[model samples]
Target: MENIFNFNDESSINNVEIHGEYSLIIVILSIIIAVVASYTALSLNKRASENSFFHKNFWLFLASLCLGFGIWSMHFVGMSAFSLPVSMSYNNIMTVLSIIPAMLASFIAFYLANLPRRNLWTYFFAGIAMGTGISSMHYLGMYGMEMDVVYTYNPILFLASICIAIVVSVIAVYIFSTVQKYETNYKVQLIISLIIGLAISSMHYTGMAAMNFYIPKGYEMNLSHFHSTEMYGLAIIVTLGMTILLGILLLSSFIDRFIEYRANYYDPFTQLPNRRLFEKKLHSPKVLAVWHIHDLEHINREFNYAFGDEVIRRLVYIFKTLTPSKVEIYRIEGHRIALIARDGDSAKQLKGSLKEIATVLRKPIIVKGHEVYLYGVCAVSDANQYENTPNIYTNVLAVLNYPSITYNHDIVYYDSSIHTYTFEREIADDVNRAMNDDELFLVYQPKVCLNPNETVGLEALLRWNHPKYGFLSPAVFVPILEEYDRMVKVTDWIIGRVCQQIADWKLENISFKQVAINIPGEYVTSPLLLKLLTQKLNEYGLESSQIELEITENSFVKNMEEAMRAVGEFRKEGFSVALDDFGTGVSSLSYLKQMPISTLKIDKSFIDDVPISPKDSAIVQAIVTLGESLNLNVVIEGVETKEQVNFLKGASRKPIFQGYYFAKPMQPHELIQWYRETRVED
Candidate 1:
């Protein structure tokens, strides 16, 4: 019985050695092919994960071919190492046919490994397919052998070889799945490749060892005698072809990865390197300038996104045309173009370049037959500003809200003394935490009514005793909050706190004629602030007349009409509005008339020099007389010295004052106690 399964007598099989007679170079070459192909496949794996559906499929298919060819190459090379005693030839058709199963098995294994999502069942099925396919390929190649003998096999040993293949397949798939795309552990991969090579080799030789070949005495061969020369030529041709295929795949993967790298770090619309690449190269001695498009949002809102995109593209051209070769331009964020000088230069040169950029941007561009005018602010890096920061983009963005930059629309260089990026972030974080954690509280500075010799009112001031940075002044933290646009939120919190305190004082039988809270200039006209104020007053069951909103002079100076309207709204709603920092701002008399102000608080600068500088005395008298003529109560703040107080009294018929001279700002309880103690004297 030829091709029979001989279960009973194992002695019927020919003695087969696992190694047989093999060329060391051929065996080593096959292992090398496996290692190289496997490594290339791993390289493509990460890209396959990140790519689009179509591109991912393309890479995955190539990976399958890459790994499959290596497996096919290893099998062929290992087969060539097997030396038979009798003259042997292979059926040409079957020898070629064996590669089909080998490649199919490889594809199944790779497809399972590269599946976007995977689990236990997919792995199990993939292992079964790969193991069965490898076993079938080995036997198919064996079946191609033409010799004057009948072949038989030990079923148990043959089954064991298949089992070994299946187990190895599962292990290989597990390793592939566990490996990360971006990170390649070369040592682990090398070890894995070696292990897989040995496992596949073991299965091939084990199956071979289980097979038996016998002459059967009557068997006759009609085929041509096998030649060593043709076998060598066949081996060389197959090895060369597989080698070339793997090489091409490896080269293609390298190029694809390079292109992917470039795409990730660049803005596709502008074809400019993005913020990520800029930050990677951020360092001292390199000048950076950020240009912000002032009206991009308006353009986007008026026109379509496509029109906005076109506008940005045109702006990119201007940047490219005007920028020198030495300076690298990057489209960092939305409507923001950043310039970095590759050649180390002073901030002065960058500042000039930024000014030129701003001037060029002032011109108009035609987009789709509609002339579009551009306006923007350019902020330049300072030469002497030395602060190590992770995100230079954010550091530059900090300039966007600077008073210097906000008003002038010119290049505001980074000032290390005034602009501290890290400190700002720390303070913001602490403030937010304090807001949430009830760590913030308030203190009050008493306002004296001179004629009555009593504390008439108290200005509610925000206070924070930070665990790390103790007793932070409003001057230090408030400006930073405003720059970050968090002042509105802080103000809302402050309003609630102040209203609750006022309610608490009522319960304690402590009273004041009025209480004032300083409001940011930006919030003077805010509807939200008005709504919040109305709600808080109602919540505390207090009248609006009891609380005053103190606004800075700059608010009225910047937007007179809006400021006046806001002041009128406050007064109409039964709340008093006062103009703070009176003498320091431009057009002092203009603010008094333009604003519907009930009180004018003379700023400390003019009051500080009173009685000492004669010029300061004239300025104080003028402000006092102006307030009296307008029928507005005048408050002189920061009145520290007895001499300044004397001068203020002589200059004005009556004076209401606030500052350290009368009493420093105190906690709510301390204010109540001081009032109780001072009421007796009045």
Candidate 2:
């Protein structure tokens, strides 16, 4: 065996240069330990910051042990790779004590990394602290080496190793902090771990290069009880132990992260993806349909919330089982489920799937021995039609929430027309403010007796002069108010203003018959309508006969029995009831015989083509003959031409007339002036 250095020739010891060779296997093992330890520590530190106090402290402690012991093992393993001429061993106590600095350094680094906010100086200081601790650990471990020779260091190389440790630690810490938010990005973590591992190896090898070991002149080397093999065995055991510990910690961290991801992106009840995941997927090009359980609230109100939840689960189950495989369903809202079509699926396919789901939902879902039926509508939007994810989502929501869909039950697709719905939604939000700001008012259109051509009554029409939109038609804002259920308030306001206007007319000694105020079909059945009407009539000291209640034929479509009962109550209260928009609805003939009414007003659609279209003229004649036979006063609406009036005159009875032919709807003051001027003309 050849010794790299020999102290037997004491006289030549000063001139002999000591050099050592390294075991490639041990060097490689040491590098592996460094990388594994760095990754484990960084992963644990990330978990520490995201957890509760107890778990955070627990993770932090584990991270410190992993990093500190990991660094110590690498140092000893590297030292074991070097073959010295004389036998060498480490002081067990000193070697064990050197790990304290590494652990403390790890704690400092982890603490700084988890800070809520940090600047450049924070990392610089953290690096300096960690680098100093690492440097101290290396030097202390070197000092623990037991041998007969004295060792010195090259000052420049020693300082350079410390600087290298600091610089690399700073870079590694910055990288970990930057990527910690992206927990799923393991590749970046691995790359950072490699950097840290190489940096540790570089510092260790650099420090080793700075070492100058020599035998003192005339001094004998001690080889008694010094086993180089035992040192190598110890290094191997420590490295293996730390590696196993770090591996377990890494596995635990991954398991915890997976559980957290599931909790975040999944709906526990339905076992489907949640809104959070759905929103994330919206960034891609796809067709999306949102199905809302419109009647789920009714179930919740009828039964208990638990029953509602069970119904929702059953509905979702139906959706999953019936929809195509390409459709991905998500529980985006409590009562809404969003369906997304994959790359190969088109909007048409998605719509077909929605229809299938709706068809299935029509069947009863038996829960708790009670049969529950669900009614929902689906709104579809294609990402390709929109500029971005937000626009697609907004447009889809607008289409879904459009007022007509509530009653129509048809699957609606997002298109340019939905912008009108979106605008109406905005107006719906401002309706209360509009009422408060005096933007809402009313105008009157007078109804005249045909033969005498005398103004008998007026139809009070509600109008909104929105500051932004400027004079929104009742056809526009009225439906929005009805959809949002804000019409109750507006209806109240209308009754109050109409009553006040009638009182003002009486004070002016203007002889007027009755003012007809149109009421929404939904409100016709509400007790509030009767209550508010009675309250306003009494408040303004007006008679019920002075205010005629005009309701469209569709009002009876929902609950004809209830509507008929409500109308009978109004008629008994001395209020005139008029069936408006005649011949437009399907159940008109049946309802006309049952409903208690004083007047029949033909819808403008049939009147618009009358006298020009013989069919329309025949229809109008039949309605007038029917109204006279039923002993109901008939008013022909939209009579814009003299020919139409002449055709109406041929009817057996003279019907009242209301249209632009007489006069357009006018403001209150304009109505007064028109009334005075009309009387003068007559």
Candidate 3:
């Protein structure tokens, strides 16, 4: 043991002392290389966990290569900085082989860092594995030196170097694990990189301190060639090569991040900022307005979806061209676009802009060589009035859905006066509950024949007895249900209940004419309604003539062809159809000529002040005359006084009257009792 191992004692006289000097510039450069490499590896590791299996493995491999080559380059650069009082060079094969340990160590470190479940024990084992690899690489590279000298190490300092390396590895692993929690925190990354760089440098220098080199007795030192240019050139080449590789990796990562950001924050179809980005940009004192394309679904159904998409693109383009630069637009949802204004006069300016856009939208837009007419309405709200952006967004969406505001092509500013919006929102949220809890029911109003002075038929009116808000009128909740696309289900429920009631009435020996049901505009146009009515009638073992369908004039306004076809189908099946709420819509006179109807019921608005109001009397006279001219059965509604009845009786033709004048809407039992009493009197 004494012959093989020679402990280098400082007091020995035969040993030659050789001190090495360092180039300050090369030392600093080595430290920078270590830091850059660490940052790149850490950044890569951060993204690895978020990637797919293939991408995650690819990133890990690249990170390992970067850190491995970086450490190798830094080691050589640091070695090139140290100059001894002798000529020294390294074996090429050994120098290359030393990098294997570094890469292996890097892979281990990153793999452990990316483990799904980690603990103190995981980090400690990772540190131990990494520290062993680093120590082996350092000693192996040190031994690769070819020189006419003997090498020795101080036992205590040698162990101390290994300890320092292990400690640094533990710390690097811990910091790498912690720093990943913060996203893109460049300041913290820099600080961590610096600390890692300093720690690596400390371990390398400590290993160097442990090393001692002495010239053999017979060897002669060539001091003149101590500074080798070739060696310095090698270090520079390695550093540059590693830097270029890292730079390429960084560029690739940046491109990936950019694509990810675009996908997350922008809508692919409109190429506009999406709801996520819009919500992020919401701040105080900003005016928010949402423009909803009311007839977009109709357009999509009539044409193809592609044509509808083109329409939206064109609308967005028009909005961008017409609105000022201060107003930022976002594609919030299907058929809905949102705008935010940040200027001082944003509310007034935004309202004006909305009106301009609405006017422009009224004109038919040419898409795919087809002239497509679209109806849009804007709901504007002040952000300052709300507590947060979410509140503003919620209320604005509710306001946009207001039945009066929809399809009007007008801009409505939200205020306390728009209480209908709030009430409608409540109704929409609770309507399903209303159905499940049997809160919805029907009341029948008797339509009397004026000439015979007897009850002719009954009109079924829907009523909601809400647990929270009692006795809600159909006028308030029906439109809400329609706006929310829930009318079809409610209408189905209504039809089923009416059919069962008619069956029950027959069992009780109650004799009456057919009962009239007011079908919503949506139900009238929907193909499902006819099928449902047929199914219900057959299920109840009743003929179609026992039930009557009352459709409003506006029902024809949506899709006249479909509404007319559906009504025609109903009439063909032996069911009578009444054009309810007559003479209320703008094109009622024009549509009356085409509508296939058995009855025309005048709206109550024209009958509320009939005797005194000359205009009301004249309108009523014209409607009655029009019904008689067409030979259609006319029903006058909202007659609460006998004077209105006398006036109607004086008309050229007698018509059915339904109002509070004779009998209000009643329950099933009351209607049965009233029918028997009326029949007895007749």
Candidate 4:
């Protein structure tokens, strides 16, 4: 039944192939069709989301179909040639050439049609229109070809063609899904998908055509065929057509993504839900949900953004699995937890117990192969109250900051009457004060050597004493600075003051090893980092080696390239760089080699329960081994108990320690007095 248009003839003819005026028209028209189809396919793929039925990559296969048909046109026109008689059946022969690519287009459109979608029937009818148009046009066109050819095994050509089609369609589907995976406007994905579509299509069409080309029983190598310029030209033309068209499609796809990416709302980092995505979920009061992270700064600091991102990812997955199938999520600026919960009568009990529901929603996040215990505070509000539409975010934030949540770190219910604008007002006022006030000062947390109990160094921590609002920890104000880009200024002040303190200690003959300054992760990546530190240290007449910089793993892990560069700049200038909060985050061995590190400071979490906690002992042992292997110093912080010190005294061979056991962090005047007393008393 399939062999009606089949011919297995390999009879050689002493006639030229494709040397007629009509053949030229077929090739040209075919090329135009191929061009149109390829571009259309790419356009379809780019707008995959806007259309329901077409799998994201359906357009990719469409491109392949166009290119394949174009090649078929070019190939057959080249095939049906003669030294004498003109091809009266050129249209009929062309029909055979165009069928496969059309079939492929049909197959792809059908796949998309079957997928779960709203307007699938529209695509189904369009698929009918295009598929019918292509096939009918080809069948009517092939009537002029006196010779009929069918796919067969002896030639090994037709099998390759069918295989190629199957592969192209499958690959187009795969590429479409993979490219759309991140849902971004990045150039690489589009380029790769287009290339894949072309490659798969080329292989399919060429394989199908290759089946008709039979080796005359034993002349398989066809050295003659290789020598023939016509055959070579045909292949070259075919390859060029597919390549050029596909290449253009690929480029256009990339350009489209770039444009859409710029036009649409997005967050480049974390790739989670963004503010725009959140807005998309604002339609139905019963169809929306929002979750605001309570301690983003702590997450950013404790493990750095790398782990912080992991926490966000886990939280997303948790809520995603927990929510109803139709729910949507958005992450707003990576701070202040906010989630819009769907208030549906469908789930009556679930809607009423909002607080209980929120607690279940807020759970621990796993990062770096270890579970990080955290509690979430969220702002879930009723979207039904369409009060002031323009200022929904303000209300959302207010709902998130409901006064009840000020004390409760866990999730809180949404209340319309209670506005949580008081703290934000205070913070704004404090920020205004910080711009002019030189009152941000330092407190020295004493660091001591374990065996001798001798004071080694002091970690400089920032303390803000606002005239209006008592004393403030770095925890509160640091976030404000980070949010407002004032962190750099604050960091500069800490560095300068710490350097000045080190110089004063030197003048008093304290020989107080090093003063460590806390560095914010976001600010550490500046190219002028070294210049800033050099200027500060030189201004104080302090040696570079006298100052140490401490970066919590959270900061260190977040911006690896910048972090390493900053560390290298410091170490190159003879300053020491230490990894603060060791054992609290994912410590890649590669970083140990890349970073300009002098020390690893054990975090307080590990130290607070050391000697008693076996886990701490194991972590300390591992860190010490790592330090020894890398030839860097290891210092344990927060060593208050003698048992902890005694444990460190034996286990750490050349170890340095810092903790409350030596002395508490003091003021600059107190540091000077402590330095003088140590010298005079000794």
Best by TM-score: 1
Off by over 4 Å in 1: 1-24, 31-64, 81-100, 103-128, 142-164, 167-188, 208-264, 301-303, 345-359, 385-399, 403-682
Q: By descending TM-score, how would the candidates be arranged? A: 1, 3, 2, 4
Residue-pair clashes, model 1 = 0
Question: What lDDT tens digits, residue by residue, belong to model 3 across residues 491-609?
Answer: 78888998999898888776466889888887787778888888998998888998899988888988889888999999999999998888888664777888899989999889878
What is the Å distance of residue 677 in model 4 from its true position? 4.3
- Looking at model 2, report the run of 10 residues with the lowest lDDT sum: 221-230
Going through the candidates in the order shown, the clash numbers are: 0, 0, 0, 32
- Give the top-scoring candidate (lDDT): 2
Q: What is the model-wide C-alpha lDDT for candidate 2?
A: 0.77
Error of 1 at 336 (Å): 1.1
**Between 1 and 4, whose lDDT is larger?**
1
Candidate 3: list runs displaced more than 4 Å: 1-20, 28-66, 84-101, 113-125, 135-199, 202-265, 283-286, 298-308, 345-356, 366-371, 381-399, 405-408, 412-682
* 10 residues in a row with least lDDT, candidate 4: 13-22
For model 3, the local distance difference test gives 0.76
RMSD score of candidate 1 (Å): 25.2
Ranking by lDDT: 2, 3, 1, 4
lDDT of 1 by residue, 11-119 (tens): 3354322212456666676666666766665555444643322366676667666666666666667666555444667799998888778667766776777665678
Candidate 4 achieves a global lDDT of: 0.55
Q: After aligning candidate 2 to the native by TM-score, how far in Å is the CA of 114 from where it should be?
A: 7.0
